[model samples]
Target: MTPQNPNLARELSLLLALATLWGSSYTFIKIGVETIPPVTLIAARTLIAGAILLAVLRHRQVRLPSDRQTWRRFFLQACLNSVIPFTLIAWAEQSVDAGLAVILNSATPIFTFLLTVLITRHEQATTRKLFGVIAGLAGICLVIGVEAIGGLGESLMAQLAIIAATICYAGAAIFGKNFRGLDPAVPAAGSLISGAVILLPVSLVVDRPWELSPSAASILALLALSAFSTALAFAIYFRLVQTLGSVGTTSQAYLRVPIGVAIGIVFLGERLSSTAWIGLACVIAGVAAMTMPRRSEYRAAQSAGNR
Candidate 1:
């Protein structure tokens, strides 16, 4: 379907809501990690989200795939989308500033574009998509500023980890196409369960949560992150992928930058420079250019004028 199709409005709304949910997650992670270990934090996040989704599945009567192959694909998707990326981002946030981390993670669309073009070949890399990717990256750089790069040498590993998480996210977006026939909520719940199962033993061995005491604030943050960000956010995400395609769904990365910055400013008392404001403008423009459908009539009109 074309981007300008009637469904695009609903998709864009869902995209914005998903962005807001995920954009706030960096702040939640930053708070949660101050006391909670990364592995334990991730385990808790996925398990809690998984449990809630499980309840929803039963309530809605959504049947999960009993077939081993589908379950196996679900596990791989869990690792790529949730288990690895979530853990990496949590670990990386232990050192990296939340704003900077958000900026780095915004590279997801670029990775998504490349993977779609090279590996999955699920979506054609149209000129609009290519330009949107470049413009989105430029907007992120402008939003965050070059000064943020000065600290990269100090947090090189952490920064790289976040970048790696973005790569995994890109891969997950493409790989998720395998579940097209399944209910979105089914995979969303199943993947979280898979991630939790994978991380549970590791967290137990490494963090030993029995010995660790977290603040009430940290506990609340973890709950919010799991409920809103992971559970609800991902359900919407998979639905978007089925409808909008990978490029369109991954385009939420661009929206996340601005939304993340705004959350920081409003809640964290962080400041945005004038350049950052300009960058937000660029992000809006880029998203419009990329996602807005090219009408056949408009293309024909332009062709006739050129001829």
Candidate 2:
């Protein structure tokens, strides 16, 4: 099968949608975790999201992959992409502020770039791409402010957990390349199902969710988290990885910082500092640079120009 070429407009829209979906997830997690344990919250999120995706698959008559190797890959993807990161973020947020969490999570692209260079070789290392990653990270620090990094030393374990989650996210993006030809939803559904399988038993033993009573608000937050943030977001994420490759997909990390800030400004009546506005601009520029055609593509275009 021919590689699916990236459509700038469509992919940008999807990226924005995904960033918004995920950026808002912190809010839901904060609300839900007030009454629900982290493990239980994660399990509920994945299980419900997995069920939703499976329902959609059945309606579309898309059979889940039956091959053992594909199933193994799906399980590994789930561990890296959802279970580990989601659990870590949820637990870390119990101790760390959401601002600090976002900052640490924003390091995903840097890890992704490093993995691509060292292990995957799925994306070539270019100076432009490296600069973009650095600029985007700098933009995140500006947008969130340097003060958020102050408590990093206090909550050493939580901070490290968040960073570890970012590494898993980077790995998942690269590992997901193996699913290029399959339906995007298949890998997404499979991953979520695998995450649910891994987390449910633990949640049952640890949280005993059935014995705990949760508030209506927490329940609704969990529902939204599962439906919008996990299921739908994962579907789009897999599609983006297939079309744009790992580095490009993980560039959404930069996009999430601005989106989160925008949400706060618009919905919570929060004001952005002058630094934040400038940082947002830098993020846009960095993402554009990162996603721009590579040197090979540029050279091919130049040669065609002469021809």
Candidate 3:
């Protein structure tokens, strides 16, 4: 659908909301992994978020798919969306700074665009999208400041893990389109349930979470992450996959960098460098370029000629 469609506006707004939800997740994750082992932390995240989504589904009288094939797809989505990426990010955060992680992980749209053009051909590969990718990357580099790059070469292994997780996210955005026929919450809930099932056993075996003593702050952070970041965010995410297509939906990756910085400004009394202000503008422009419907560009060109 074109950006002129009213629904597209709502979807774009949802995209911004999704960015805000996920932007705060790094802080929550950093706090959560302090005492809780990565496996245990992510296992609980999926479990809690899945349960919440399931409850919402039930409230809406929606049921998850019962077929084996659908469940298999859900399992794969779980791996790409949560089971692997979640654990990787949580583990990496132990050694990697959140700034570097955000900058590296924000490359999801670029990967999504490449994968679409090369493998899936799921969406149109327009020049606008290509520009969006370049601009978004530049914006992220500026938003985090040059100082953040100092950690890049230091935590080589952990930095690599974040990139791996970013790739998984790219795959998830494309694959998630497969669930278009189902209610957004159905796949969201199903995937999280699948993730919990996969990770719980591993957490039990590896972390022995029963013996661990987590701080109250960490526990609260886990709850916030599970509820806001995972449960609610996945519901919105799946909807955007249906409405916005993969590349457009993944533009939220660019939005999250600036949103995270804004969160810091409001809550932590942080000030943005001039570069960061410029980065915020670039991010807005990049997201616009990525999401602006082709028809809008045509209308603008026609109007300019008439003028």
Best by lDDT: 3
Q: For candidate 2, lDDT tens digit of each residue in 1-307? A: 1123435567778888988898888777877887999999999999999999999999999999999999999999999999999999999888876656777898899999998898777677888888889889888878987676566788899899999999999999899999988999999999999999999999989999889999999899899999999999999999988876788788888888877666666644645556998788788877877776755665664576566
lDDT of 2: 0.85
The global C-alpha lDDT for each of the candidates, from Candidate 1 onward, is 0.86, 0.85, 0.88
Better of 2 and 3 by TM-score: 3
Q: Write the per-residue lDDT of candidate 3 for residues 245-273, one digit (tens) a residue.
A: 88998999999998876766665455566
What is candidate 1's lDDT per residue for 1-307, written digit by digit as tens? Answer: 2322345567789988998999999999999999999999999999999999998999998878899998898799999999999999999999988889999898888898888788777676889888888888888888877877667787789999999999999999888877887888988998999999999999999999999999999999999999999999989988888867777788888889989988888877877767987898788767766666667734654465566
Model 1, which residues run further than 4 Å from truth?
Answer: 1-6, 296-307
Candidate 2 lDDT trough over 10 residues, lowest sum: 1-10
Q: Give the range of the ten consecutive residues with the poorest summed lDDT in model 3.
A: 1-10
Clashes of each: 0, 0, 0
- Rank order (by lDDT, best first): 3, 1, 2
